[model samples]
Target: MAIHLVGLALLMGVIISIYLPMITQTAKILGSGPMANIPFFAIALVSSIVIAIASGSRTEQFQKVATLPLWLLTAGVMSAGMIIGSSFLIPRIGIGAFFVLLVSGQVLAGMVFGYFGLFGVPASALTVGKVLGALLVIAGVYLVTFK
Candidate 1:
């Protein structure tokens, strides 16, 4: 299970690396704002539907979605906001700078969320090692984002 999770994480890294460039190009080509979501999400929706059908998962499971807290539903909104913001920023900042800044924010947020166990995250106390690692990452972010 751990091996599969590691593999999945590695795959996600590749996808995110490609995703930044692809979305940046798409935004440049479209010459439109958030409307770029139209084609991107259209493809995503179709791909997701096909995958869902192929996976043989039970559609009935989605019925439980309504039982979840309303705040949980906002995750979709957050995803859209992230994509849109990334599209707008990547071209101006350069992908390397943008990715580092994004990573920096995620690291900080991940630490806080894990520490407090907010939004379903498992509680984990902040340790000196984690703080040092985060500080190193933040310093890296500053170096990459600035001159």
Candidate 2:
């Protein structure tokens, strides 16, 4: 269990620490090229499709997705907006500020989501500790971006 937890942590860390920068740079470069965001995201979509098919989970995943509520289908639309926004914003804001603000927004939204048990997630009360942790994240973001 501990090993699995560590592996998951490492995976997330790599996504944030390494993958995010690479993708952001790719977006920036592609934004400057003649092709622009469409080709970049198209490639990403193709890559994801290939990976999903290769993983042999597509059948089960599609079945599950078919059963999901209509509102859940909007996730793809939201993801497209994030990808497009990131392609445009990262070049202007720089990765540091962009990620900081992105993470801050995610944390804030997570708090609300958890508090209200949104998206069928189990209800988790917003304790004082959670608020303090969020405040610390905000302060950290301010420190990182301003200093």
Candidate 3:
């Protein structure tokens, strides 16, 4: 579990480094629109397909996908909105401020999602400690953005 967390963090850092520059460039060249996301999604889909094939779990994954609820499919929609929004906002706000705000929003949303057990995850009630941690995240974002 800890290794998975570390791996995910590393992957996220790499993706962010790649995404911020790429998306910002896309916005500059293409001007943010459905077209901007077209290449982004296309690349993501291709990459996913490649990874799925490389993992040799194509059949298992396809079976699992069939079992997944329709609501889970909305993740693509959410991802598109995030990517489009980031493409538009990062160019305007600067990556530092954009990431601070983005991370702050993610932290807050995660807390709420965990508290409510949204999307079928195990319920984890919001506690005082969690609230304090979230507040610190907001304070950190403010300090980074304003200071």
lDDT of 1 by residue, 48-78 (tens): 8788778888477557767988888888788
TM accuracy, model 2: 0.74
For candidate 2, lDDT tens digit of each residue in 1-147?
699999998689667656555556766666542235466568888998899999886887867867888888898778666666766777787778888888899889989988899977788999999999999999989998887
Q: List clashing residue pairs in candidate 2.
A: none
- Candidate of highest lDDT: 1
What is the per-residue lDDT of model 3 for residues 1-147, given as tens digits with 9 covering 90 to 100? Answer: 699999999899779868866876886788665568888889889999899999886887777887878888999898888878877887677788888898888889888888889867777988999989998998999898888
How well does each candidate superpose onto the true structure, as a TM-score?
A: 0.89, 0.74, 0.83
By summed lDDT, the worst window of 10 consecutive residues in model 1 runs over: 57-66
**lDDT by candidate, in order shown:** 0.84, 0.77, 0.83
Q: After superposition, how far is residue 114 of candidate 2 from its true place, in Å?
A: 0.6
lDDT of prediction 2? 0.77
Extract clashing residue pairs from model 3.
Answer: none
- Global lDDT of model 1: 0.84
How does candidate 3 fare on TM-score? 0.83
On the 0 to 100 scale, the lDDT of residue 108 in model 2 is 92
Better of 2 and 3 by lDDT: 3
RMSD of 3: 2.3
Higher lDDT: candidate 1 or 3?
1
Q: Looking at candidate 1, what is the lDDT of residue 76?
A: 73
